[model samples]
Target chain A: MFQPHADRIAKPLLAAAALVCAAVLVLIIAVIISGAWPALISQDLVVFITDASWYPLEGQFGMLSMLLASLLVMMIAILLAAPMGIICAIFIAYIAPVRVQKIYRFAIALLAGMPSVVLGLWGLTVLVPLVNKWSPPGLSLLLAGIVLAVMILPTVALTSLAAFKSLPIALQQAASALGVRQHVQILKVFIPAASAAILSGMLLAMARALGETMVVLMVAGNVVQFPSGLMEPVRTLTANIALEMAYATDQHRAALFVSGLLLTAMVLVMMSFAARIKGHNDYG
Target chain B: MAEHLFQFVIWCVALLVLMVLLWLVYGLLDHGLAKLSFEFLLSEPQNAGRDGGIISILVATLLILAVTLLAALPLGLASAVWLAEFTATHHFWARKVRLALDVMAGVPSIVFGLFGYAFFGIFMGMGFSVLSGGLTLACMILPVFIRTCEIGLRGVNNSWRQGAAALGMPKIKAVWYILLPAAMPAISAGLILGIGRATAETAALMFTSGYVDRMPESVMDSGRALSVHIYDLSMNVTGGDAAAQASALLLLMIIIVLNMLAYAVTDLWLGRRLSNDLA
Candidate 1:
């Protein structure tokens, strides 16, 4: 039934079609670098990246503060989300009734699907104000981190759930055979066994939190200063890029591209690291 | 005592997430849903989106969705078919393609926005039009489409393929006529989820589609999307919070409906297969 000529054509055609994703990846990096070249070449790359000031009018484009804010806020977000996510995963995987488990799963999926902008709007209107009542200005690092924590919760929870669900049946049986109580088995046996997967989930969520734009953009206050406290407003690398890209010109445009490059590189590193550390027992 | 304490902590943590979820949904409905009306849905914004409605922005959002699906569908399906059917699971190029897709998925939306602005808007001379935003969005959602279509194609049973082969059917014909139809539901389910994603995206569209309030006369016209509309109102417009909240309610309702539809479709598909097995 196969035509020889058609076979030759189809194979190449399909291969070329499949290559589009790879091609697009290459194009994105190349385009971004080329766009950023004007700034990268003229300015001292080290000083431009290391200095804390970001005066675009005078062309003082240091991203040190924003970078620090991005890392600091991401760390804060992961700290808040990871424990909750892991515990939530534990509840869903082992404790919840089957019917409750189904509902929780659906709820988490719906939560994940909720747009970031809407969440940002909520953060701006509700969370920021709430934080402000206690902490003077509400749109600060703390508010951004809290919003991010909420945003990335489902990512961590879902991954941790998959990780726990894949725990070997024998391990649970062994713990039970040894006459361990349910809580003890979970703490000593299940948690220890699922730790690698839990760590993997944390890392993935860290990557997501780091890359998340809208929620933090709306609530993070977009100040390019070093965050001395969680109550102080901070600008993230992502917020910096998004806030400036539209009106940025000449050196400013290139500087934004440079930050874009940095953001892309940071995310890719986290992804690769997550991929590397991912537990093999997942999907087992 | 230690075990009880730990259990309490775990329960509290779990309940926290559930509480947050409920609070968000309930708060949006209470604060924003009251403001929503059919007039609000069908009219254009007045006073920088602080008042009136969101009909134009909704149309722009739908237009972007159309262009995104148009650009994404054929290429995504073809690649998914390639990954699922033609190549070894661990083939070098196949793995590379998969890796690229994974990396692409992780890249921040803002980066895509920059790329869209530089490549499509400036270099390609589209200049923040719906066409540019749509193409960028197409790229952004491509991984979702490919991954979903791949799963659907893989779900087509191996026995069916063997049966077709035994009947001396060409591989292409079998895939086209049998596998494609069998996987259509799952593929469409993926599309629904992708729609949720595309609808929610804001950063990527901010630069690629300039936030003009009017209905796009052509794909080349710049326009605001629902998410972008909400962002603009929240940031720039005074007393825009009310309008933003109202738009948020509509956006949330739309997303929840899409997700529910996706769940229902997948469930229905599985239920049908189970019943057929019993028969």
Candidate 2:
């Protein structure tokens, strides 16, 4: 008798706790939108996309250079990380011995677990100096891209490993029976089978690179410019907010929120795209 | 010859990945370990961290972590229970919850800092306290904690539930006694991972916590997190690199230990389960 009543209370309580997640999401969107309302209404959207100057105090809220910088840095990161990470995953899944594979996986986890700030610290002290020898200024899009690549490599490798592990063993066996070479089988059969999951992983990594703050702030040199080359300094949308948020007020503050809103939208769009791919994979 | 060349390239790539990890670890240890000492761990900063130790920063980090876990753990566990037990997998509400979690998980830490500043600092008026920082971290990490715990709970055998129902066990009672105990390893693993993340965080806590290096009097007091301290010491303070290295080493050790603990918990649990099954 008492147990039934307890169950009734407990079930609803648990559900209410679960509903808090959905509520939090709604609240986040509401808060960001409201914070950004002033700038959103004040400025034309084209100004954000077309104009490159970002002098917030003088009332010019152009973010085009930073926007392009964010995308370019992410592109550099993806271009460098994707092939290397996928190859690492292939080596682990198909080539490495069992003991070696386990160790490699653990190393990858340790890499993933390293704080972003620490990576930034390394980039600041070590990588930046190393790049300075050739580039004159150590902090640039190329250096940031390298740091970001290291940060996201584990994500790509881990996801691709899962993708490979999930393939039907018979597929490999049939390929071998047909006398297909190992490289040929990997290049043709296994990669094609796992492309969707691998693509999703790369997409997630790109989102992470775009949203990354401390690393870029430390190593990207914080110059708000359209980079003409890989070694040129540039600021991302994230770094802009972190750098300016402390003293920004009024329209300046609102503009930071606008940047935040743009970042949130970009990350959400990429996440949803990745989720859709994963969902399609699950069903099809 | 081609196969050999391909194998050589793969081997080189694998070695390169290993070298990166070693290089990072070596870099930190080489620069940091010489500076680390008992006194360094237990003292407070002086002259803007050019001298003295990180005891106050350590306290603030722990207090913030405590507040975060205190808030996030119960909510995360309850939500996981609800998702794994009460809701059907394909239910509309369940899908929405999962979607919300995915969105939350993908959100950048800096945005959480902005949200925390706007919501907790300004609107709610918590204002740069440990409580505000911890709550922001709780929000950021809740999705991760929930997903891990839910996966653990869902991995429980279906027959365990059926058997409980057959034995006339109350749903709550079975979940409390059986399902939770059975899922303890995963739950503990998830908890450790959450703790690791909360400890290593910098951006999300920067504004909400408001970077006061003094020892916090209470949750309401502003406290500087270790990550924030490292960032400031490395970037802002001239000649603060030695102290920053020491602090980074300490933070790195804490995260590595927590991660190892997570792995150990899962492995121990798996070993026990195997032995019991054989018996």
Best by TM-score: 2
Residue-by-residue lDDT tens digits, candidate 2, B138-244: 99889999988998887777778999978988788889999999989989999999998899889898889988999899999999999999999988999998888
User: What residue pairs are clashing in model 1?
Assistant: none
**How much TM-score does chain B earn in each model?**
0.94, 0.96
* Candidate 1: residue A68 Cα off by (Å): 0.6
Q: Model 1: how far is A236 from its true place, Å?
A: 1.2
User: How close is each model in CA RMSD to the real structure?
Assistant: 2.2, 1.9
Candidate 1 ranges with C-alpha deviation above 4 Å: A1-8, A279-284, B1-4, B269-279
Compare the candidates by lDDT and give the number of the best one: 2
**Candidate 1, B173-254: lDDT as tens digits:** 7778888888888898888988888988999999999899998999999989999999999898888888888899999999
- The per-residue C-alpha lDDT of model 1 at residue A141 equals 91
- Quality of candidate 2's docking, in CAPRI categories? medium
Give Cα-based local distance difference scores for all models: 0.87, 0.89
